[model samples]
Target: MAYCKYHPLTASTYHCESCQINQCDHCVDDDPEHPEPRCFVCAGAVDSLGATDIAPFWRRLDRAFHYPMNKQTMMLIFIASLLASLGAFIGGITGFCLSLIVTAITTKYSFLCLQRTTDGGVTAPDMNEAFSGGFKIILHIIFILIGISLMIVGVERLFGGLASVLFSIFWMVCLPAVFINYARFEQIGPAINPIEIGRLVFTLGGAYLLLLLFIAIMIASVGTLHQILEEQVYFFSAILQSIVSYYYLIVIFHLMGYLIFQKQKILGFTSRLESSEHSAGRSSQNRMLANIDVLTKEGQFDGACATFKQGLQAFPTSYELHSRFFDFLYGLNKLDEIDAFWPTYLDLVGRQGRENQASTAYQRLLLLDKHYQPTSPDVRYRIAQACFEAGKSVLVVKLLNGLHRDDPQYKALIPAYELMAKALDDLPNKREQAEKLRRMMRQLAHHST
Candidate 1:
């Protein structure tokens, strides 16, 4: 037994002959018969993409944040994954092929997602564009897996039981290695080469362990959820379980790509665009926006306005900055200014598709000042519902009453009545108000019909 190369304290089960690196059971490809593990250089042709150095996991974690939470990107991942699941359900080679195609699609978009965000842009990747390279991707995966399988089986036969267990651990950690290689090169040869795989792992060092650990935990969590659902055996539980598991898979895959992005230099990958910090600093619009933020937070309204105007000068098309400026003006009761820009502000907010935020803002506007009128009927409808859920009964009633006063034929009165009924039933204090509301609701229902 030897100490593992990565975890020095741990006992090593196998040694990689090519790289002369020692690894424990957790690091080698599991083949029960293999006499010894081979390093990535021999396993796959090493890319020598980056140095063996990687930034601290905690440090890289922050810079890696932008790519993870793009709802649009997430939706794409989910849809691709869902399609893959549907394919698998078809239960044949056809199904397998379809699933593989979707896998390639998601992988392509996943990498494109990283490039777009890490290189200083924040746009959602187009779904069609992301799904562009399906057939080539499937071929790459097929070649890699088939080639790697031979190496793995031969090694297992040479070493037998103990080496088999160790190989299993190696296989576990190699998944990301395989993905990163193919995603970067889009080729079967490098991705499947054991040497390249080993080199990538060796370069990742301890962060690789952390990545492995996170993946294990994520899989275990999803499995545990599936088990719990299985125990209940509900009619829809299987569907729910499948959805949760596939979603987790997409997240883990995204995480794998992000790891590569975080350690790009060591992995030999390069961004085609400028670094984020340099780009942000060079942008006059960004500087002015930052200045406006600081000035506004300090209550320097005049200074904030000056900074806001400065940002607008350079970024005339930036609806994001324009929206923020409108927020500032709205806060300061500069209605004249807000009204002047209402068309633009509304257009931007509408185009941005944050109707929920707009609705909430509308709610707050009406709740704070009774004189304000909502631009849409749905505003009062949603706001009152939100207020009820938050236990703002007074506000709910007030909003409902005002809407009713404004229009006796208000559209959402039924939902409002149902909510009030529930409130009256649940709260003893509100029960007294319930009867009157019920009577009015009945009267309104009768008259409307």
Candidate 2:
């Protein structure tokens, strides 16, 4: 349970042997270009010292039971349950497809809950995050479940029902470990490896048994709810049952994820949260960028600008470096330098589809020169679209005005025309202009064909 050298309240995730200092995830150098996390000061390889201060999963049963009680998590449960209910009520090919979607979504979200919980995300994750990695996890879980089930069935056939029952019990005990491994590594082989499961089960000792007890209770509670609602309307009953099952499903996964988090040190596992934070640190170009940030903060604009000049040369295409440099120059009121840099900065942000940043940068440029226009038609098209989406219709029209004469070679003419038409329609007393743009769109379509 070593505390961070800089932030005493926070648990240290890495230790710099070179600096002989304990650094939290935030303080460690997270530059992705580097092979490993480096010390902020020394730029030397640091060893991962996993968090040891977390309470065991059993000790936090109250919080574990309420983990899925958040608005986001409950909403997921309701949506999945609603789909499951419809599938059960319809009971056909369409129903089967609906049911399959529910299963996939539920399984994906449950694993995400586990992973996020392991990463120190106390609250339930949003829907966007659950589907971020796609349905790959669904396949992995299916494989693990099928492989384990087959092993149990094979034991019954080769030995006896009693022997099979014993093996089932043994597997039931190791189930949490199996899932933790699966969530941790996201590979079926490590998850199903008997040796790995056995090692994990042994390492956790009595706490593993406590986790098993909670898991059994959570599983049985779902069945108990079904029985209690046996006399209710079938459709409504199905929905309730599904919701309860998903609620406990998330809780179970959260518990397993927390178990890993609590015992990360002994398990030699770095939770995803720590790893991601560690990686999000300054990059290989961090030293210069960091020095620039420090210098800018200290009101050493001259030195910061010097470093920015050097950094921009070294990492010419780096959006982050360019962004920070742009901000610094703007703060110093270096209008000429900003004018020279604006097009490149806008293009960098536009190419990345960073709509918000591009729009903000465009506004910043607008301040410098009221008639500011990017030299590149592509950059204009992107920023105009971004402004239009942000309800800056005037900006959109201004950006796209006279584009045909200026950059007729622009490949995105059709979309640009369509966007201009829409923006025109949105503006007051511009219907005639909008219709004219619409006619141009028709003419363009006719020509392209």
Candidate 3:
């Protein structure tokens, strides 16, 4: 009874790998009778041949570490433990020194990955970029260590008890700051702030001070009471101890609850904002659609066309609605409708607007009647201009010929005729044709005079 390799839903089997239970034809690597079926999941052969296997040490190491699998997290924990042990064996001074460098490098690379992942997906940073960031963090740690050493030496040598007390305070503050700095650069955790460190110090210090004050008051009160009522004083002291213990526990639980609840609230708010943005986008699309219908009903064809266009931009696939609306506007012979819709219509057909639309409209006008023609000299000249712009010298020659024959009185075209003559001359394999065009232009020039 062979088990299915892909899905557990079906219970069927076949003699060949290609028709194996739960496996598609595409999933088969090779013919079963040729050698053996290779299990892609485990990289093992069902039918064995005495073939030597060669694989990279890194690949093996990767498999062992479970590179992309759930085991990768376990591998990271293992590495951290091993590194920490190595650090401890080297002594606190050496361990801290080396671990700082290692931590900085690892953290920096991880941070770059995190940043890229945040932007989109888990993009692998180039080795060079990773190394550069890692080195920068290493340099930062060196500077920090140098500064700390100088501070320590200066306080020890010059300042006395007061300096020692200040140094103690500084050490407590600096330890957390250093941890945060390393974490940020290495990308281990949240960014560090000197202000945050100061706040933590002040908060915890105040709490400790308050606790000591309360303890002192309790002791003093008990001592005073003991002389007057020794037996009653012991019971009062026991009660005071119990009350203090309970108060501390309540404060701890309250702090824990606040941290957990606030985190959940922040996550919920972020989700709601994302959903709201999607809803707003949908609402804007609906509003544009409504505006289109209103404008068309009012017989504001031009305004309606423009509004419909704006709606299309908001929702591109609203072409079915736009097409029906456009046909209604076209029936009115609205020239502005032609101007407004022609560009987008040409774009949808994947044709260049200025050249393709003009050429197309010109051809349609010529087809209406053999003698029917464009009234605008500027439109004719622009057609010739487009030909030249497209590097179609032959087309330019043809357009200029038509324009000259149609409107000889338009003196604005002579300069264009001359320019076309020059471009025809520069065209490959058409020097003789270009000379004929120039001669024809000269004859036209003579006839005009």
Candidate 4:
């Protein structure tokens, strides 16, 4: 007799080598044919073999590096990352400087790629050619530095200090212009413009200079005012810090605005170019455009609804699509659907506006069919109707009057007017107002007829 490791079910004994549990057959469920019975500990160890039997490390790395879902873009990112990491490993300070430069370059490249992708253009850049070009740039810089050093030491000594200074200033200006031209060449092609390259350089340089100037001013102000306002300096410092913070915030907002607006313009031009190419194959383009029209057409409301939903999935920031979808759903009498879409709709519209599409949709839903019943108007109007039905005539009349004043064409208010008349028909305090409403209803009916 051998004891079961897990439980004492019955005191019957069997030697189970698979689980290494000495137990009766009732206590151990062991496979008989290959029953060199693995113990519970051995079974647990066997389960861990699945995790260890994974693909080789290099194979996993290759998949991660080369076979990204966005293959072309990811390859560019991989190259950039490899370069950045290599640069960083050289030294901490060198790494930091290189990281900044690489980050800036990669960010610009990514923006260009995104712009091209959105415009339906091929955004693939030749990585080998790009690396070769970068090497050439490094070689050029080395040559320029060597030449400048030789000229400064040899020619400047012969010419004089004043002559050397003039020459240095001239070279400083010319160097920037030359580098700008080279950068333009690097970026410009059939898909990209030289002006765009120039603009990017100008924007980055200008932003950097502005940020430096702002920091200088903030430092100067704080240092200059510190001793003069010694007692109240802390309070003044707090105020100054807040102003500096807000100024930076404003600068950030300005940069974001410029980037968004500029990118839109650039992408628009690229889209136009793609569209021109598309137009060259007029019949095919027309067919494609016709298909798009069919999908988004007003007559095919269901398809339009689906297309709008798909567009929302793709471009969630597009308020225009949400507005169009809301209209489509409203037309289909999907009043309940309004709640699901309104939050997104209002966020898109923002705080200040006259023609708030979401609010209008909500108001329209409330005025549906003019009846104020379950299948008639929406919940808000139905609540008003319920008050009238429950003999809360004063509340009903007040709500209806407010609605009539705010939106005279609210269809539910017509029924509200009639209900108000009935609710106040014989009431001692409201007979005169009720009579006037009945007269007005009569006139409305006459005019409508």
Q: Tens digits of per-residue lDDT for model 1 on 1-449?
A: 34756667875544555666665433443232334223322442211112123345455544444444567656765666566667767859888877777777766666665445433233446767766776676676677777767767777899986776777667667977887777667667777777888998998787778888877887788788877787674535544655556455545555565566566666555432233223223344554564455346446688778777777666766877887887787788775565455455455555665434444554556554666654444555555565666666665565565455666666887777777576566665877787888888888888888
Evaluation by TM-score, superior candidate among 2 and 4? 2
**lDDT by residue for model 3 over 59-78, one digit each (tens)?**
33333223223343333334
Which residue runs of candidate 1 sit more than 4 Å off their true CA positions? Answer: 1-71, 77-101, 111-124, 156-168, 231-239, 265-449
Model 2, position 384, has a per-residue lDDT of 89
Model 4 residue 76 CA deviation (Å) reads 26
Cα lDDT computed for each candidate against the true fold: 0.61, 0.80, 0.46, 0.46
* Clash number for each model: 31, 1, 2, 5
Please list the residue runs of candidate 2 whose C-alpha ends up more than 4 Å from where it truly belongs after superposition: 1-13, 23-48, 131-139, 156-161, 272-449
Error of 2 at 141 (Å): 3.6
lDDT, candidate 1, at 426: 64
**Candidate 1: lDDT of 144?**
72
TM-scores, each model vs. reference? 0.44, 0.54, 0.26, 0.25
Residue-level lDDT for 50 in candidate 3: 13
Candidate 3 to truth, TM: 0.26
lDDT over C-alpha atoms for residue 297 of model 3: 45
Model 3's lDDT to the true fold?
0.46
Alpha-carbon RMSD to native, per candidate: 22.2, 18.1, 27.3, 27.7
| Candidate 2 C-alpha lDDT tens digits along 59-113 | 8889888888888888989998998999989988999988877787788888888
- Number of clashes found in candidate 2: 1
